[model samples]
Target: MDKIISNKEKSYLAVTLSGDNDKEVIKQMASALEEEGYVKDTFADAIVKRESIYPTGLPVGEINVAIPHTDPEHVNNAAVCLGILDKPVTFNVMGMEGETTEVSLLFMLSIKHKEDQMGMLQKLISLCQDQNTLKEILAKDQDKINEVMTALVEK
Candidate 1:
């Protein structure tokens, strides 16, 4: 398993996602990571199950997003799959049961080390809090997305 954090070419940035539901979207992202050797074959199922119990959907200032991930046992390497959905999909809001959000961005994290997971989530949450940066990410293309992700992780 290769570390994709520092390698721009290996960045798993999906320019467009067509999944109509959260499960479908997560499966698509997990499948991509699995193909790149970042995660095990069981990653998709694990993440889907985890998501149901502890949702990752965050309602940022303007744009809602999700950070879906599973245990380190299901991951072979540390990587993130940034999925930009073509249309918003419904996802249960984190820490808010019975409430849902329409998320257009999904950040599927596959972190091999448990210690690194919170650090990565902090960076992503920081990025989410910054409306300007989030807007820039949404406006940018695949290459630019890679740069943004690389810079964020490196920080």
Candidate 2:
């Protein structure tokens, strides 16, 4: 499989955020992504709408995670923006109506190509499923997180 995340892209991984809710967190992350030139300004609203309609929350063992993404039109470049929230935020679980999950980690995908989405998503799911990897991601510094994530994508 092709490498899903690049070293330059890994620099976009953020360690923490102060958002109190999903919308707030997404907005903040999207804005940061825009500033980094990874996404267009419209990405924030597009992702929020996508999340509301098709939530990305996944229950991965002890920690809940969310992968929020939108159509390729809103992307300036391809990169994964990782955000670890200070507190868990509620998000509706994928494929489950009316049920929600408390999410602490957010993976905001800015992909310029539509075809690469599924492959990258599958890798992300794999990463989430590994407890050891998740622990490393949650506890590591930005550089270490980038190293771990880069290694995962290259595998």
Candidate 3:
């Protein structure tokens, strides 16, 4: 796989929201990305809209994860902002409406090019499917998380 995410891009890793729900968590993550200049001012609202229409939640191994992203027009740069929720939040399963999963991880993608989204998503799915890899990611600190994710995306 090509390295779609660089170390600077992976620098947005965070552990967030034990007390908040899915919408709140998404807002928080979007705020961070926006502050970092990875996304545009309208990014948060766009993310909410996109996720509402096409939920990104997926059941990967024993853990549930979400890959929330909006159209490239809402992005200023390319990056992957990761959030590890302190507790699981419910997100409707992707491709399966009326069903939900408790999502603990979020991969908020900020890609400036529409063409790169699917490729980035494929690499993310590959990373999410590995139980050992997810465990390693969950156990690491922010710096370590960046290292782990960068390695995974690069490979």
Candidate 3: list runs displaced more than 4 Å.
Answer: 1-12, 141-144, 152-155
RMSD of each: 3.7, 4.8, 4.9
TM-score of each: 0.88, 0.88, 0.86
**C-alpha positional error of residue 105 in candidate 3 after TM-score superposition, expressed in Å:** 0.7
Cα deviation at 46, candidate 1, in Å, is 0.2
Clashing pairs in 1: none
**Candidate 2, superposed: residue stretches over 4 Å from native:** 1-11, 152-155
**Candidates 1 and 2: which is better by lDDT?**
1
Cα TM-score of candidate 2: 0.88
Per-candidate Cα lDDT values, in order, are 0.80, 0.78, 0.76
Residue-wise C-alpha lDDT for candidate 1, range 20-104, written one tens digit per residue:
7999988888887888788999999999999999999999967789999999999887777887777789999999999999997
Candidate 1 lands at a TM-score of 0.88
Residue-wise C-alpha lDDT for candidate 2, range 1-155, written one tens digit per residue: 11222356444446467677889989988887887788888999999999999999998877789999999999987877777777788989999999999997788888888988998898889788877767666664556677655654452
On residues 8-89, what C-alpha lDDT tens digit does candidate 3 reach at each position? Answer: 5444445455535678888888887887778899999999989999999998767789999999889888777777777789
State each candidate's clash count. 0, 0, 0
